[model samples]
Target: MTTTQPIGVAVIGAGMAGRAHLAGYRAASTMYDAGLPGIRLVAVADIHEPFARDAARRYGYQRAETDWRAIAEAPDIDAVSVVVANPLHREIVEGLLAAGKHVLCEKPLAPTVADAEAMVRAAERSGRVAATGFTLRRSPAINAVRRQVTEGPLGRVQHFNGHYWCDYGHNSDAPMSWRYRGGPGSGALSDIGSHLVDVGEYFCGPVRGVRGAVLSIQVPDRPVPLGAAVGHSAAVEVSTERRRVGNEDIATFTATFASGAVGTFSVSRIARGLANALGFEVFSEGGAATFDMSRPAEFTLADSAPPADSDGYRRVVVGPQHAYIAAGLPMDFPGVGHGQNDFFAWQARAFLEQIAGLDRLPHCPTLADGLHNLRVLDAIVSSATADGKAVTVQ
Candidate 1:
């Protein structure tokens, strides 16, 4: 039974990605005309009061909260976006779910697979819509490529080469934070590799095993921050002490999919000259398709049986005809481009749609998917630990 009452929404982080979730929720209703109920920008929460207030004021939320529990306790809040640190996910999510609030959590579900499994169980027992924030899956270009490969035309995907590279950890002076904590495969692999793994599985199929994995740390230690750090930005002031970086800054792995597709994946936070360079190529018996997040508006397609004298890739500009294009933007034309943040809006819409019972098959990744992603990461870590020995995904 769908209610016409406005669905109250809250966000539990006031950092970089949290702000994106705030804007996404504000723009969610405007993206599509699924007769979604009005959304209430109820509250913005962060342990840092000032940040919370800033985000709330910037996004037109009703209030700011320093305590996330306030959101769970509030009767008016129907849904929440948990964008806090990875270690804090399980407790907050469990509390919110117990309060009967639908949740949308950012990726890497938790620091460990065991934690993710517990969260999944909590979501199941609560009977609430628990979604993982695999934001890249909302890209129109990526979805179009997925359709081509999974349906036909790209018949029997044989191989997938994907990489997500960033420069966030290039600066050794960057202060120590939770992002650099945990064991091997917990840093760059979990930070960005999770997205790559999810996309690889989304394109081909579930990863059956992983092998030939390597994890490396570029900067071994960083100065302790003198003040509270937000997101990945380095703290302006730092103490004389330095902490040892416990995880890898770069990760490379080979995966075998259940559908006989082989995948080569790489992720790095120390890749110089690459801000968010996520791109992938899927090769199949019939054809191949490639997409670069840097060029969000288009994809390159190579048909095996091209017309005579034309045996190369052709650029395909995504237009309103593509998935999430029609009614997804105010100007749904081909050249009118969208960015990473627009994905959060699309994701928010999908989450809200599921909450309203407007759709049975949710477009967003479920808690189960999130757990599976962690398992894949665990396999990579185990492989790297065992001298690159093959490790089957649990």
Candidate 2:
């Protein structure tokens, strides 16, 4: 006798992040079939038929729909992956929860704090598993760092610095995308700063308060696509048709965590020569720990107790012994090919395992995590608008 897979999965949205989720699910399914419990990719949904169709075919989904509601309400799909833009998060997530489907939503859960709170509440009341895509928390290196800090291997945590920098805005001609908009919780802070904020919380604990500064530069006026050209790659005369963006391309903030740890974070889309350069460092009484996405397979550990003659950071290569490391696929096998592949794969597996009743979901960075991140983001915007005056992160 053969046992069937336990759950049916649906992927919502067909953009960059949606594609990543599809790839992750597909990879997880492949891995599961090779000994792990498997999940079936049953359906996919997107506003764009082409994207939905193509992704469904590529990811081995059995069905595709242009309306997300169809996937959300489909009795066959047991879980939904929400990878749409920030503005659509609340509606989609609430709908999925109401439909009795488990949800895994991408980061920056909602466009506003109120909406994020509502989403959290809905998830809580629905009695369904809900998870936010704060991918950094799943990183092996970061996990190792978290272990060191928590276990006192790194002694008392003192200072933390996290930076997420990219060159997406350096091109003066880069067409206006939802990411550069204001109302959608777009801009540097929500797009990338969310990750930094999550990392800060993960390492040092909750943020009590924060102060920040924001700046908008580079292609202040972007050409808007005309009728029938929306979401298509096209360029026309630059027009300042939309209200000057109320969001910033760069933001830097400082915060005090619940553990009394002081931390600093900076996020930028205008930095030239950088592409998705996310890195963080934790300074403790005994030592310092660092991880740079640019150098994926290695983490650095400094000896705070180094002899007076020499004090420096030692590089630690993540190998087979690291957590989540299965036999053949050594920690360093993939290298930077997918900077956080192991972590992401592990997260996917965990989600699948939870659906299969094999494990309990982590209580961390849950819906509450999204709300806290949003509150911090709101505080950042308020502080920036107030000329860097400190704002309490409620």
Candidate 3:
């Protein structure tokens, strides 16, 4: 059997997304091998030593480092995944790119528009692969929608509606973290809403304007943590004292696309019983389609606008029609459910290819793409601060 040299890779941040990245890299070799380079799980880094070490052991990485700079400086590491928090992205990404290592940072790019812009500049200067964790772009069913929008059936996209709601912060005693950073470009709008912004651009086109937005602080205060906190819904000790939430809990906005199609998007961290409820619909003159991974392996489409009495959506099972589904499974048909990790593995393959200098695919969200979404998000906050007035996104 012919073999290729393993490309050394590292993952920073041992939190939730970090584990997903580990699994994706591990499975890439097994799931998709065409033009795939040999991969070596080299290291995992986190500020908290225990967390980093634990992830390394579980994921079979060769080393665990408390300082991310160690991974960046390590001569053997060819690429690194920056799964750190939003505020920390610029520093870690810039460092990795400067060290001549390709990097993949998780979404929202950074906490503020300025920070995202700086990261984009660094990526442009580095000339190495720089990608964001926009895993949904690889969704099999969603890709089916993209195919038709770009080629087959759907006429000019007229409107887009997206909702990414969650109940992780519904509890009044949730612990404080950098997620709730106040003023602007923070909270649910920047957290979950950024993904929706990307979705809008994917299905329709770039957002030309954010006409207005309403931001709400539903759960004003949360229990102050006595010590380090874990996941969003994990149990952690907290003091009786409360800290006012620095950002919003719920946000809704209206956007106009470059293609003249308008869109509406909303996100909430406090919506009860809606854990990861991400769903969207695109409407055009001829038809409409809806996709929600929350349902897993299913999407609805009305291929053409029927008579008013017969207008309805038809269930489309994820099958051979969607090209990427075959990569995740032995068969190229629908009804074979797609797990969240499947998307991650698909994303990993593209990232590895870029790092290997093989076939550079078209859809890995670059720092420039991330900056575009950040600009839209920044405009949302700007519009909200001005009391629901119109704001053109730069």
Q: What is the number of backbone collisions in each predicted candidate, taken in the order shown?
A: 0, 0, 3
* Better-scoring candidate (lDDT), 1 or 3: 1
Candidate 3 ranges with C-alpha deviation above 4 Å: 1-4, 305-311, 330-333
Model 3 lDDT, full chain set? 0.83
Which tens-of-lDDT digit does each residue in 1-394 have in candidate 2? 1224667788898766786777777766544324445577888898878888888898788988999899877888887889887889999999999999888988888889999989999989998878888977767677777778888479768999889998877775656667767742368889889999888888888888987655454457565544312221344344555434556778887898878999988888888999779999999987899999898777899865677777788888765555454432333353423356555556676676666655443432578778888988888888777888889888
Q: What lDDT would each prediction earn against the true structure?
A: 0.92, 0.76, 0.83
Q: Which scores greater on lDDT, model 2 or model 3?
A: 3
- Model 3, span 133-170: residue lDDT tens: 88888888787887778886787789999999999888
Tens-digit per-residue lDDT, 1-394, candidate 1:
3667899999999999999999999998887676898999999999989999999999999999999999999999999999988999999999999999999999989999999999999999998889999999899999888888878588788999999999989999889988998889789999999999999998888999999999999899998988877788875688899999999999999999999999999999999999899999999888999999999989998876677798888998999988888888989887898888899899999999888878732468999999999999999999999999999999
* Pairs that collide, model 2: none
Error of 3 at 195 (Å): 0.4
TM-score leaderboard ranking: 1, 3, 2
Best by TM-score: 1
In candidate 1, the residue pairs with backbone N, CA or C atoms under 3 Å apart (3 or more residues apart, or in different chains) clash, namely none
